[model samples]
Target chain A: MSNLEQIAKLSGFSKATVSRVLNQSRHVSQPTRDKILAIMEELDYVPNGNAISLSKGQTMQIGMVTEGINEVMLPFLNSFVETASQYGYQTIIYTSSGDPKKELQAFEDMRRKRVDALVISTCVNDLALLGSYCKYGPIVSWQRMENPQIASVAMNQYDGYTLGLEHVISRGRTRIANAYGRPSSINTLGRIEAYEDAARRHGLAELPQWSRTGIHSIRQGEELVREMLAVEDPLQRPDAVLCSNDLVAAGIVSEARRRRLRVPEDLAVVGFDNTELAHTLGITSIYNPIADQAKNAFHLLLAKLGGACEPQQKLQYCLVQRATT
Target chain B: MSNLEQIAKLSGFSKATVSRVLNQSRHVSQPTRDKILAIMEELDYVPNGNAISLSKGQTMQIGMVTEGINEVMLPFLNSFVETASQYGYQTIIYTSSGDPKKELQAFEDMRRKRVDALVISTCVNDLALLGSYCKYGPIVSWQRMENPQIASVAMNQYDGYTLGLEHVISRGRTRIANAYGRPSSINTLGRIEAYEDAARRHGLAELPQWSRTGIHSIRQGEELVREMLAVEDPLQRPDAVLCSNDLVAAGIVSEARRRRLRVPEDLAVVGFDNTELAHTLGITSIYNPIADQAKNAFHLLLAKLGGACEPQQKLQYCLVQRATT
Candidate 1:
């Protein structure tokens, strides 16, 4: 049978009634609606939702901005996109590459694309440039500092670092070294403060030589370890090393092995952001609760979209101890 | 001066001309254009690119589909998004979660959103569902089998495995153990075939008892290693183990350590997909060029979008020998 004949016979309705239901031009009786729905389902008819939405002047799409994609943030990005998909909103991802100009451009592009909302995890320190874009739509920042102008979902970095330091102190490590991320970043700064404060509270002087700052990469960790090992005095060598993240800590452990030093026995190591690498390496580290952070970021963005008041959301962190400490 | 007055005075042109140039409405002379550009640059004016694009009926958005986000694929995702941004396109990512249903859904959503192009690294074996989406715009698959109906870019997995397996065989290990991925996966199947063929060619019978299949996770690796060690006789146990990926290799090492087995001394271990974990663990593994694969996928997608002839792009892989093997 032809398509129209099949629809009419299946619905037990006239062609005019079927057409009206198909086009939604007029209201139909409940019995007629039920019959038409069953017929459509039986025929495996797939309606084009986009076409209907377009006819009604609506498009569902969102934008997500992130820092340089790498192991550090891949899981989070994946989760965010998947969750956004559940809400019938498509997500556009922009990589800022830790550049301010690129971040500004990304926001501008999202605005141009007319995305309903945006989730940003860029590296720019200031939020002033993002004000105009935020005004255009709901803007949410993830795993970063709280912005008064935009809702933010961030992990408690200070507490996470403190927990790591406290774990090391619990292990009776007196002299400690730290391989931290860039000091310019707010998250890194929080870690540095926590380290100093925790050390001072434990009755140890925070030595300047024991701290090194660099990008969060294995090569940086290896370089920092080499620098530390080059110190001639035995007393100058730290008994433990704390890394900004698990990846860096793994690098430090590898470098130590190359230098013929043993882990936990010769020098205890601790890291932050308990990523999969840390779990595999059996390194003691802080769990940053990335999945929770992503969920909170989504909710915060949703709230802003619903015209709710914007508030800073800080997720909790925990210490996960392994053989390294 | 106010914004309008500043634009009029700085360009030394009529207000209408400045407005036209800002809106990109009418063709202005080159000298006038240069003067207006300089004036805008001097005034620190940031043009609303999105607003201008809207007037021109351009969306400037693209979509990407991939398996669950993890550390291994993060670098590639970052680079793809960064490059897309350079080309004035915003990218939306969809996670397939290795489910064919979700992969199909992501394609449908991308089509509904009218994405300019799509880049997918799906886990599904068939491309029939993807064919329908390709009709609307370009759809590029990454690290998957290619179909004449869809464009694809993938690594030379067979060659990479052969290289690593040959290295292990050359080391005089006859009893080889293999930790493979799911048998249903094409990539894993290729690696398994290469390994079995290499063994047969070397005059060794492929032992079913020496092979294990599981997902790519550290826990799986550890479990597989334990099962291998549980063999009744130590002499009958395999002398070497080849892992499907780095995470699995790390798990094997951890399990070996738990069983008081020294790597390369008691049982040599090798891994595929030389990720950062492999480097830090000093495990000999195959290096799959993720960046190049991503770049090639983007180029192929662009070509398909431009209605160019579709070509299957296969990238090369290498084997890096480290201390483990």
Candidate 2:
């Protein structure tokens, strides 16, 4: 059957009236409107959601909140925005500058703006405020989550770290040091556990000075590696170094170059979250499924918006072997 | 003068009444309200624009149309959103996929949602439809603009290219090549002009085989460099290569590594945009003022929303010399 005939039969209206409604040319009577609406529901007709939302005083817009914007957040943000746009929703963004007060303010403002949904990738553990916003709209956690009330799409950080450690061990490296992130962060805890577990499993001694934790930055990576090299005992010097992230790993590589040390020969290096920088540097690192997590976050939010059952989603990670390993 | 007393005198209301009104605890008569409002206006009393906008039914929300949701756009988007949030306004984003049709749809959706203002970074020369939306609310261009009616904040692309090219020439390299972007893009055209001018200034013979143009991707950069190197003319081969952007330069670097060529010794390479990848690779490149452009665009939109005169703004770029040079 033709589209016009289908619409006419579904709406119980004449073809001319259905055409008028579809074209948005003129107003139809109240009874005709009710009949057409019923038919549209029965036919499962999907009109342009944007146009419908526009007429209904809502925009179907979602909000994305994160820490300070940088190259690190680019890939994930892009994926989330593009995927959400495909679903006929626009995205609003907020950056917290790593300040707790600023983060709270962003959440309050986003809530006041009445965004249809929200996705937060924050470092703070105060999830109560975000949970309050969920009462008004769906909230999806990205990477970090402390509240079970909110749905989350997160990476298996422990597994990623384990994979990286296994790869390093397979290369016959017995003496290893780790440059990790802050101990306060949940991601850091996972990595620390995995690193220790891998050492125990391999029957290698875990040294106190070798298990270093600090902020994830290039300078920190350089400093940690320098400290490791400065150890007076030649036996204490590590044969390999594992970094918290790609930026840190790049720093380690740069410092190694400066000191004329050959990577994977003098000291093998590994990183996490195989970012674009890792790809450019040819550094072997753990590849977290960032785009996949973002896609799943959007899908989870959509499910909540549709009043569907919620489930905990954990994305997998893999070790991408390269020159550094 | 005390804040309360100043407000009281400015509004021509008693201290008690002023306090009551400020706290929204009591109502005043219409005549008294008119007198107080006139007095406040005469004194140039500045009430919070955010509170007033909220009370007037405006959502205090703005929309940003981005080119892509990748790393390049992340820093700019984050800054824009943070700044807008400071003014108690939330930002809605639309990713245009670099397609004019998707861009138009974003504008239509934002317009239908009655967004107070918009900032567009994705360039689409044709603005007839966007112009119609501009009449209803403020619309500011972020990176590129072809329409005279829309206000824009742009980076000095020519100046940036000039600096990058001059740096390469100053290094005393006679045979220089460039891995440029799409010929249709204005930014690419500027870089090409700068490349030609710089080559002539250095008294180097320009070779057609050495100059390459393609999509801004690592694979394209690798392929183009390979194709150029395949030419049998030994004397015509360039001693130095300049990439249009950091990603392309990285690809060239990777290819060079594959061919066992040492960077800056066997072949000097430079890149544009000085992104994080450039820093990680230690590649010398120009720094485009993405954040500045975004900030300026938001302020321009804010000015227009305030019913003030808007001016065209252009930000300057800087050259960052790194290890690659």
Candidate 3:
């Protein structure tokens, strides 16, 4: 007889019960699990991980696919890994580098590996393509996509942008230009809507030329500010600038300081993603709450894995005021 | 007949050749592999991942255990993941939170999961304990431990510290203080040795109390500088300060600026790790070649997996001067 059968026979338990104990199922009673485990130990039955996984129909692994591995994503990924480990699951991470083809390849690879669930921060906007994979396992996205099949967790970007714009206005700045991230992202779209609404409400002109896109890094911020300063028309120049993130804001501050321009007196800067860069540089920023979002995403995945449905979650954001403004 | 036997009969090849083709072994010729693959496709046979792994004694997975998941380690981890994926391997990451017990637990968990190899950035200094694990699989450490059994990749910390110190001295700053990370770490020990040696070579008194430890953050740097500035004796005050990392240096600069003290005139500051933080703050820092070390570590693991040994490698460090110095 096989070792599993031997353990079942010696422990006076059915084969299914012995299998449950081997898989560490909660249905098995403590004493029964102890008896079965002791018998298996005595018989020197070293359980094969692959064999056990095949039998149980579960790999105890979660696959995480992101557009890129960066400082912005590191804290979220770290929190998710920690939470997943606490639930006795390991995570396998893949980066798609913002390519749709590579993202689909990652999904296919995760399917073949038979991970229990998938958490994706996708660069692609097509939900139909993501929905077709639901047959394999549950998926949790980092963006708030309007799909009935996929669960999601995201920060309220519109409110975050509103907070930054209003803070600048409250600080007595009227002529404000904006620098934001990729134009195609839902995050950027939401922030743009907020910015337009705030400009209209505050009786400020919505200058399409002043608001720029594709500003994600420190160097980009510096370049954008230099370009703004180059316009000899002082009226066209922005008295204040709202940046896509803290990195860009730091760039603007650094470059502005190099020109001997005093912050708040010459230009007020507002940044997003209140990261450590914002704190150290004392740039007023919008806190993204990425760790909380990551934790919520894991809990949503758990609910789905347990054959339950959970409502999509949208977390809140706040403004952190500092020296730059 | 079993599927393997049927494939062997139909293809007129031995079972070993069919098994070798199934495992994607390089020994199989192209024509033979294509023919076998065509037949297998015609039969609609999908290979099971678990069964394939069990039969081949390989998992095609690598385990990465880090002390903590922070911005400092993110770049290294990202590079390693990209390189590993190029070689058809996925990584499983675990963070030990700087606890030796948790580190050991991660190792045991990886062993039970049967990962093909392990790469660790450990907090513990016990090389003997690490050497004992070689019987399971090859281990690559991020620190340069003097063990012939394990492969290692590390930056020359002494050289990195020397570059920063010498740069400050070249800029005419003779009275310099130091604020660094954990004293127990080899990196810190190496930096301290360099600092003492440089001070002695220049015929300067090495004030034991001036070189402070247990500093790894911006707040600590701020606190250390505040304490230093409070001393009434201007003769005992340092003309310059070398920080352990960019974050601490940024803190010193920020705090000094808050007190209206001019940087590089009243107090010069140097930082290690020429990260984006350093660049944004314009703080002069030492450039650590983490990506090179990660790539080299993977190549070492590849050699070991191919039944060969490799020598440990220590990458170089250089200084990048900015306005702060």
Compare the candidates by TM-score and give the number of the best one: 3
Residue-wise C-alpha lDDT for candidate 1, range A1-325, written one tens digit per residue: 8556788887779888887787876578878877887898788664444444444333466677766765667656767777666666667776676777777765665454456677876556366777667766778877465457777677657888888888888888888888877776667788888988998899987877878787589877777778877888856788888888888888888888889777887689998778878888788888887776776777677665663444535567888889887
Candidate 2 lDDT over B1-325, as tens digits, reads: 8546886777667888765665555477767766766666675454432333334536577877766765556657777887787777778777777788877776665444446778886655467668777765778876556667777777646778888778777887777887777666567777778877777777778877677777577777677567756867745667788787888888878777777667777577888777777776678888887777777877887777773444545566788988777
Clashes of 1: 3
Question: On residues A1-325, what C-alpha lDDT tens digit does candidate 3 reach at each position?
Answer: 9777888889999999998887788999899999998888787576767676666667777888876676677778888888787787778877666667766755675556547788886557377887877767888988766677887787668999999999989888888888978877778889899999999999988878878888888888888778877988867788889988888899999888887667877789998888877887888889998887888888888887883445545568899999988
Worst 10 residues of 1 chain A by lDDT: A49-58
Please give the range of 10 consecutive residues that has the lowest summed lDDT in model 1 chain B. Answer: B49-58
Candidate 1: deviation at residue B209, Å? 2.5
Best model per lDDT? 3
Please say which candidate is ahead in DockQ: 2 or 3.
Answer: 3
Worst 10 residues of 3 chain A by lDDT: A307-316
DockQ for all candidate structures vs. native:
0.39, 0.29, 0.50
Q: Candidate 1's C-alpha lDDT?
A: 0.74
Deviation (Å) of B178 in candidate 1:
2.3
In order, the Cα lDDT scores of the candidates are 0.74, 0.73, 0.80
**Docking level for model 1:** acceptable
RMSD per candidate (Å) reads: 6.0, 9.2, 4.7
Question: Per-residue error at B22 for model 1, in Å?
Answer: 8.4
Runs in model 3 lying further than 4 Å from the true structure: A1-46, A122-126, A307-314, B1-46, B124-127, B307-314
Off by over 4 Å in 1: A1-59, A307-315, B1-58, B307-314
